[model samples]
Target: MSVNPFPEMDSVSTAEPEPSPFDPIPRGEPVPDWEEARIVWKSTWNIHVYGFATIFLLFTIFSTYRFLKLYSFKAARMSNGYQLKLGLYIAICLFSLLRSLVLFTDAYNSWNIFPPILAKVLWSLAYPCLIGAFTVLLAVLLATTNACHRGKSLASSYKHGIGMGCCLLGYTALVVTADWAVMYSQRSIFLLVLCQVIFIAWGTIVMIGYASIACKITRDLSRTPLNVDRGLLRSFARLLCVCSVIGGICILMKFYAAVSTFSSRSESEDSPQPWRWLAFETTQRAIECSMCLLLILITGRADRKREILVVPKIMCNGITIISGLESGTVLKDIRLKDKQIIH
Candidate 1:
């Protein structure tokens, strides 16, 4: 009677059910071939990579052109300040190129076209390059300021610049080593947080330096000679302020990312969403390139022949005398009157 009531249930097989399409492969089955498996699992091409590559390439080209044009100018080669500025521009170009390569490597790694190790290596290299470029920029700013305000040549600041550059390089090396060690050996979240915190502090200091430089320029503009374009100086001061603010925002974003990662318990949560991270990265790059371009323009205009008058005081005195003579032959008349009075 019980069998009759549950005939359909009894008829159902007790053997393991067939695997559904969404189900994982059964343990008894042979593993799929790598090529076949990859074909099935491969992700779509990363559009962010293409966008980043294009932006960076364009920036690199423009920067290179500007650098070449500036370098070709006789004045640029002759002036220590101009040379320092050229160095900064070249460093920016290199940074952009390296960033593009790093992005490409990362995209290739994600597509399985290149090994993940290549991406890691490129990232490490790119990070150092970034630090170096930043250091060069800072040194240029300091040297330029000293040259303008204190009448000190870039050559005089060489010792200080070298010391600062070495310190930054050493710090970057330590951070890179710690990052790799933590990634490979310990994988400690605390260590990661500490590294991020240290980086944040360093970045903050750099931004503060930028802000201070901006303020100094603004304060000194009133005392700057009329020969220097006041408008250009003001624009440069404003640009520096903008850079400092933007840099601060970037630091805050990095801090937020670190906090979010620390709070997240799962790997998925810890990892930034692709589109969001891509947008952040793109925005950051765009701002950086734009700032560099603006810097080039401002400096170029400032370096124009008429913007800064380097005429000697002797030339100025001669010119003043010539102008006085042109107004009237007063000196000759005075000499004739003196001769008549003596007779």
Candidate 2:
């Protein structure tokens, strides 16, 4: 018998390296076990938030329908800028509802079941919409207080709406490039959340200031039945402030999540209270929904005020009947005239 001098050669064997359990982490693509994330949400989140979110979604849809009816009912009362402001408000509500729906779907799937590009696009669209909503709010307050009113002023709300559309486009471009080019890295996401938190806080302050002015102005209009009281304004401001704080907390959690995710600490920390994205989203939607419901209530009350006076509902037939034919007049003149028929 002879002992082999080099035993290292004898140990060679046939085996393949383990396949990737998931795609690159930067892509934010979920691994196979990502479905287990549902358990994390189930254990950690407040059940009530979920309940509120459901109610909110349904209520918002109903409110939107009612608002459209209200628009038709008193079409002549609202100026073009005013109509545009209301339209923007609806857009905000729609976006908020969309976010809630996406969150529910994410929880149900236990991961970002949304494709990377789609996920990025949706998120990108969200920020601008949210910011635009607030911008219109500010614009309305400014308009009501002074000549800042668009469709009625040099600085038009229509321009703001158009600007927001542009913003959405810009953000979409940025996010698509970032997600694909940069891998949606932890540092980048963390920084993004941090900036969002700061902006949220600042925005809350701005909202409070503007809302205070709006409330004061509304109170002076004793003759107008639709004048919103200071109480409602205060409530809205307070809610905005609260949401801002919550936003900060959520950003922190997101930062930690990004950190843990990238460092692979999630595997080692077997804690039951796993911070979850779905839970954060639920909380966010709960707060936002509450705010939106309040706005809907206010708008609904304002619109129906005439009903209390027993005004009959205006019915618009599908016909655009015109009186004397003015050849030289442009489309604007007709639109203005059409808008003059009040309920």
Candidate 3:
């Protein structure tokens, strides 16, 4: 029967406070349904990405196996060119294996089979290996061409080794720093853009290096004598050109991906179909596998040529001499009788 004079106070006391727009999600709680949907969609696309990585892994493993088998007994005697190639193959195997694992973890993370953080950790580990592999591959290509022309290993130079090591370390540090900034800092977009810029610069430098090497090889091939194997030099030059083209394409794709990601972030958009990104990654992996296959084939041919030109020992005047029959040449006889008597 009595009217309440403090109705506004009672209503205010009973009403719940609205959440702030800047509120952080509580830990150990599910994200919004939309966020979960985006995560699932992205992770699902990782299945195709990892599938391509698996194929690349198989190719790297086969390459490493073939290289090892081809040089099984010659490891100790391998030139710097071969050693660099061996290192490149090993690094690629590690990179591909880690990359596949990372992608698989991402795919599984969507289903809660693996933690999301695990995929990030795997990626962090894999990226450095990728840089290392790329460094070694570049070194091998340069060294191979130089060795072919000089008839000696350029990679054996201490200065060259030091320069390569410094470059690898510097790039690894840059990548790690960029990844750390992306994962931990609030200014992720700026850091991501910086990383992409760095990548573009690196790609440009690599393309230039390949171009110069290709040009030098072409010049040498034109002026080299008929006895030199022109085909091998041409093949290496072609490979360098191919690599440059592939690297340029990858850089452009990466730039596009970075632009899209930044635009999506700015728009507060989620659940952009993952297929576009995954398709780009799949194409990259396929190209890498094909390049590795080509490298293995080319190296195999070089090894066969070396085997064919290997001289057989012949006994002459109770002393050993190397026959150059396969090479269509003769060598001066070394009189070892006096040296043997002195020994």
Off by over 4 Å in 2: 1-53, 77-80, 108-112, 147-160, 168-209, 218-272, 275-282, 305-343
Worst 10 residues of 1 by lDDT: 318-327
* Model 3: per-residue Cα lDDT over 249-299, one tens digit each: 766766776676667656766454444544565676666565556445544
Count of backbone clashes, every candidate in sequence: 0, 0, 0
Q: Mind giving the per-residue lDDT tens digits that candidate 1 earns over 1-343?
A: 3447766775586556775544322111012243443454344224556676777777678778877877777744554355555655676677678767766655424444544334444544554444445545555565445423334444355543566557656766665555454444434445556657766887787778778767766766665544445675577778778877776776687677566555554433434444455456566666656555555554454345423312111121222111010112342454456567679
Poorest 10 consecutive residues by lDDT, candidate 3: 325-334
Cα lDDT tens digits for candidate 2, 1-343: 9998977666654355564644444334223244465455554444634565577568657757765665665542443245545655576666667666655565332455876556655554555555455545545434433332223543353464675466545654554555554344444555444444544564555455455544443343343223223354345445545544543453454455455544544254442333544545556555566545544543343344322211111113312122111122332454465466432
How accurate locally, in lDDT, is each candidate? 0.54, 0.47, 0.54
**Order of all candidates by TM-score, from best down to worst?**
3, 1, 2
> Which residue pairs in model 1 clash with each other?
none
TM-score of 2: 0.56
Q: TM-score for model 3?
A: 0.66
Best by TM-score: 3
